[model samples]
Target: MLFSSLLFIFQFLPVFFIIYYLSPIRFRNLILFLASVFFYAWGEPRFVILILISILINYIAGIFIERYDRNEKIRVTILVLSIIYNIGTLMFFKYFNFIIENINYIFKGDISFIDIPLPLGISFYTFQIMSYTIDVYRRDTKAERSYINLGAYLCMFPQLIAGPIVVYTQVSKELRKRSYYLKDIEKGLRIFILGLGSKVLIANNVGGLWDDMAQIGYANISMPLAWLGLLSFSLQIYFDFNGYSLMAIGLGKMLGFDFPQNFNFPYISKSVTEYWRRWHITLSTWFKEYLYIPLGGNRKGKLRTYINLFIVWSVTGLWHGASWNFIFWGIYFFVLLSLEKLFLKKWLEKNVILSRIYTILAILLGWMIFAITELENIKIYFGRLFSFSISEDWIYYLRNYGMILVIGILFSTPFLKKWYDKQANKILCNILLLVIFLLSIAYLVDAAYNPFLYFRF
Candidate 1:
């Protein structure tokens, strides 16, 4: 049930929108919850039951935590249990095989790996539910007495799979009360169309170049070709994930729920610390609130603060996948961020362009790790990136992909929005928007490459 799929566009979404608009205002939450469940179940019917059980467990835990507020120990016990349950389910479904394989490799024991199927969106939805329970226990939000509203909060389909990690507090009020104005619908349509164009017109095309180059593998890569592949991948991931987030936010707008923004031109950041602030803003904030703050945050001494930062980021990386690569990526980031904190801050403060270049290079190198399956291949890729094994075919690929690479880099920054905003007159804007909309549809109909990256997760 990809948001960009033909069935979703023609069938599921249309039917859901019709029913939702026709339903009474009081029953809207119930309708939304049912639709969300249907959305999940349509993809993975067996796992829908598991998710429902999780929802019920967390929902009940939240109630108990609120009810036993006078007994701090009891409240803490319930909260801990709820978190453990959520994380335990996530670990079992997502990481069991990963853990088993690692253990088997480490020791000479032959442990058969369990073939556990990961439920679609379990990582995302589990975090959402845990945030709900924790917020209730921490007094940041009240426990929703209405189960229907709570269900709606948990299962909102827009951000359910590849999320902006919408917190329970952000849309709790919207769950109970929302209005669908014509203005909101219009704005949402514009945002959605822009996101669609980004995917179909730019990201998918650039991703094809990435895939084609990567198939050649790192062994044959010339320096220019290697750099081209890395650059294309960096752009592909940005457009893919950010495009998805835009669609999610736009869909939330159409539904009259104001989901927060996820990205903010992160590639423009002059430091790794700044980049994290701008990129995946929601997830970063969630980690800060739920994980970092609880671990004494920066209140601890400098050394402990660094340790806390590393641990939190390592967990963040592991959360992305149950792989050593992700863990290394986390540590990679931790080292850069720590260096900025400890020594480089003052030096970078005096040299803006140098700082920006350093930050971009670090991020690009980090993404090389994220893109590779194994560390050895990543090392080989880096070696090729620095070597001068230029070939005619590799140069041909680079020249062919050069224009798209430029467009992707431009798109990564804020220039497109600036240009779009500079245009005046409603009629002119609407015409341009219509052109983009038509092009998006045309691309969807004709494009050969349309990979949804987060679908793997």
Candidate 2:
């Protein structure tokens, strides 16, 4: 159930909102939990059981961890078991086939691959569960005694699919007690509409341009056209994921739960370090908190810090997908970030224009690595991007998609948002939002090239 689809927008959301607001305060969590389960089951009914099992395991584990808090070894053991259960389930469904295929290739063994369907949002919910158990073990948060509250927090439909990776402690209070207000509803609606417009009007349309260019074979594409195509993909991916994050946050607000912001105009970042700080802020924070910091972080000195970064990034890339190219994409940023930390940071800071150019080019090239999975195709595409070849098709695509590219680039910065915020009389602003909403509806109705890019992750 995509948020942009008419079925979700016109049917599921309206029904859920009405029932939720009308329900008695005491039963609200029950209402939300039921709705979330239904929403998850709507796409893949079988996976509901899998998710239920996960919630049950983590819920019970949290209680046991709290009960055994006086016994450090037992508490730690429970936490380890919970983590293993969550990650093992994720690996079985998401990475089992990936591992088997690689094994067969390496050893020339006939390993029969298991055909497992990845449950929707397994990556997201698994991490959420792990965070809860770990927090309990560390005594950072009390174990959630109410299964209903725990289930609601873990399976809330808005952030369940693709997430800002909400930690348990962040929303524990809201799960137990929350309030709704007219102002919150208004704010939430405005944010939701803005995200809808970004996804429909900007992301989907530019995604089509990228698809068209990709159909032009990599070998035949000229350098300029290759760059244009990759640029289009870069825009499409940013708007798609960021737009989804905004919609999730907006919905969270409407439900009287505060979700963290996931993006912060990352394209404007002048360094790879800065870019990671801004882009997918929640995911980066998760790795830093759960993985990097635990691995001694910078406290262990320079060599260990670099080693920690390598491990974190390698896993980060694998988290994105079960592909070698994604791993390369991770290492690609690792190299750039390492250089910046070692020496490039000083030089980049001294030259503003050059720094921006370098950052943009580096990010653009990284997108190219991310956009394709096959090594052969990636090699050919890179050849096209750097071959200095010329073709008429590049001009044709530019003429068609030039304005959209301009709009995408502009929105990637804070220019439009700053302008919107400066308006004192919000009548014009409201009117603009209405226009965007209507335009988004028209696009959704047409249902052209609408894909949630991060759902695979």
Q: TM-score winner among the candidates?
A: 2
Model 2: per-residue lDDT, tens digit, 1-457?
A: 9988899999999999999999899899999999999999998799998888888999999999999778999988888898888889888898999999999999998989877887888889888889999888888999999888899998999999999899999999999888899898888888899899889899998887778866777888889999899899999999999999999998999999999999999999989899999999999999999999999999999999999999999999989888999999999999999999999999999999999999999999999888898989999999998998886888888998999999999999998899998862489999999999999998888776788999988
TM-score (C-alpha, index-matched) for candidate 2: 0.99
Candidate 2 regions with alpha-carbon error over 4 angstroms: none
Candidate 1 lDDT, 1-457, residue by residue in tens: 8776667777998899899888898988898889999998898888988878887888899899999989999999999999899999998999999988988888977899887888888888888999999999989998888777888888888888889899899998888788889889888877877777777677887887668766887787788778778788888888888888888888899899999899999999989999999988988999999899999899989988998999998998888888888889999999998999999978888999999999888988988888886889888988988888877666787678889888889888888788777773368888987897787777777765677787666
Superposed Cα deviation of residue 168, candidate 1 (Å): 0.6
The clash count for each model shown is 0, 0
Q: What is the TM-score of each candidate against the true structure?
A: 0.97, 0.99
Which candidate achieves the best lDDT against the true structure? 2
lDDT of each: 0.85, 0.91
Model 1 regions more than 4 Å off: 422-425
lDDT of 2 at 189: 88
Listed per candidate, the RMSD to the true structure in angstroms reads: 1.4, 1.0
Deviation of model 1 at 63, angstroms: 0.7
